[model samples]
Target: MTDSPNSATAAVTLVSGPAGTGSIDDFELFYARRALGRFRARLGRQGLLDLLAADIDEGNAFLRESARASDGGYTGGTTVLSTQGLGAGEFVAWMDKAFADENVLLAAQPEHYLMVGQANGSVHVVENVGPHICSFYLGDWAAEAMAWADDADELLPKADFPYKKATNLFLADGTIVGRVLIQFGETDDGFTSSLTVYLPASCPQDVLDHHLRHFAVEFRNWITAAAAARA
Candidate 1:
């Protein structure tokens, strides 16, 4: 079960890198394919539940331990990413357990996106080619981004910052470990600029590396298309 109210968190992808995409469509494609691949690989082992509840643990690193559940001899684990003051090795070690839990990793298979490592407290392997599976949870994957975006939208609106075309939350892919949001605004010279933000290390290093590099290019391309559309 879920911990205290404050500890509640859902798995999501927030990809915020430097503003590079020259348009919007390009950014969408970048995140859709490359970033999605990266995120899938990152969760090669850990189930979605562990990633969503990552905020509950006090440790900055994610942990995976095979413990017995109250019901059947189900597997149980814990993690604490985005906590604070955790070493790199410790973080990676905890994340790697996802693999030990299963012999599979996302880096080895790029096409396998939108996976569910565990269902009904049991382990199962899946790939992106089948179905989005996201419909199974219905807005669950976007929880992190939605939570933060709601607050940001309110605060920004109050400040009258002219909230521009803000759309499409980023999933954990490549170097991005959390949800990413895309926002754009017009400058005094009538130039549109955008910014990307990363949630944290929600997944593995190798996986993040692959998604981020590709996403950055995608973001840039997206920005370009967005600007063109506005013109």
Candidate 2:
């Protein structure tokens, strides 16, 4: 367990588990099972597949690029952060809005997302993780995620898991390089979030570690921004 650099009013603890071991397909399947099970249960088998297919069609530029770049390998880590006075719902809304504004996104994690520029509907982000300027489909799966969070059935209630959002990363040329999956659960005083970053398996250990730290730093700052918005 390690603490990332944070503001005086924010407490963000990051615990990085072992790097994922497997081919890129294995990595994708692992996360799909963990993150999409509830959606499957709610959407039914065929419905879930349809939703996924639609999402892929809408924003698969990165997927196309990743296939060309990753060479059948991938690595990633999850960082868990617990903080006070911010609910999962509030943070999710703020995050969605922040992505639309390059300034807000960069402000939240300047150390990691050094620069953010608009390219078509996606954002081209320059980060400390690598030398390339990455392109990300910020709203990828966002609508579906919000819908899932809002629709709570008797079998799977919202009280159990409050919010979730998944988006992807790509190179400027459209090759997929990484992904981000965030799940947030409400706590007594605030919330706990699991921030996961997936990179091509060939990424160095230091780069993977830096990404975990990057998640910690950016999210801590975003929590502060969300709190200020509420005020």
Candidate 3:
């Protein structure tokens, strides 16, 4: 922790007092630790969408459109979501069919995570992890990794996504050892359309491995399933 004459103390600060951080997004994930979390498959598409909709600010429009309708604020805010995990390509195809968008961008990434865009104002942000699609709690994995990455860095960069890094590692069970970032971006068959998934290099090893495995399996299944149905 260093201090300077020209900044907000040159140290990390918490925003949980008087104003409750005003906006949940205000909380800076100065460091996030990664841990071994679990994932389970949900019953159906709607089931998964419901879970993703939780905790999201509603004014974004995509959530509103997907979950039926809403008042336009709590149900419409910027709803950037992280999937438990998914195959980069398969998830996009699902979005293409589900939203019936002729121009959807689905990106397959190295860490078994996928990023899809529901930018049309009335679309879905869905990812199909294997049967373990429920939830993979990165434990404080991403958090701790973020901190380690922070101290080692001569710089402090923002995720440019809904996620962030924070401190507070030391999980009760066992301490997570390591983590990293994987980036994936893709465009539709048309070339001018796209979606980008920027996962910071702040995550642990096993957790990262799981996503890689998850992506490989689920993505293949997604493609196979789609082909089977078509045939």
Best by TM-score: 2
lDDT of 3 by residue, 1-231 (tens): 422223463455454565544443233221111110112122233443465544222312222232233221111011112332334344445534633422221322212222332343322223322112211212232434554445433222333222232322111132221232322233233111111111223322332344445445434444444444445
- The model with the greatest lDDT is 2
How much does candidate 1 score in TM-score?
Answer: 0.28
Q: Which candidate, 1 or 3, has the higher TM-score?
A: 1
Comparison by lDDT, 2 against 3, better one: 2
Q: What is the C-alpha lDDT profile of model 1 across 125-197, one tens digit per residue?
A: 2332111111111122232345555645322341322332222321222111133343333334332223333
lDDT of candidates 1 onward, in order:
0.33, 0.60, 0.30
Q: In model 1, which runs have C-alpha deviations exceeding 4 angstroms?
A: 1-145, 150-161, 164-178, 192-194, 197-202, 227-231
**Could you estimate the TM-score for every candidate?**
0.28, 0.58, 0.25
- Whole-model alpha-carbon lDDT for candidate 2: 0.60
Q: What local lDDT does model 2 show for residue 60?
A: 44
Candidate 1: lDDT of 43? 66
Candidate 3 deviant stretches above 4 angstroms: 1-95, 98-198
Question: Model 3, 159: alpha-carbon shift in Å?
Answer: 32
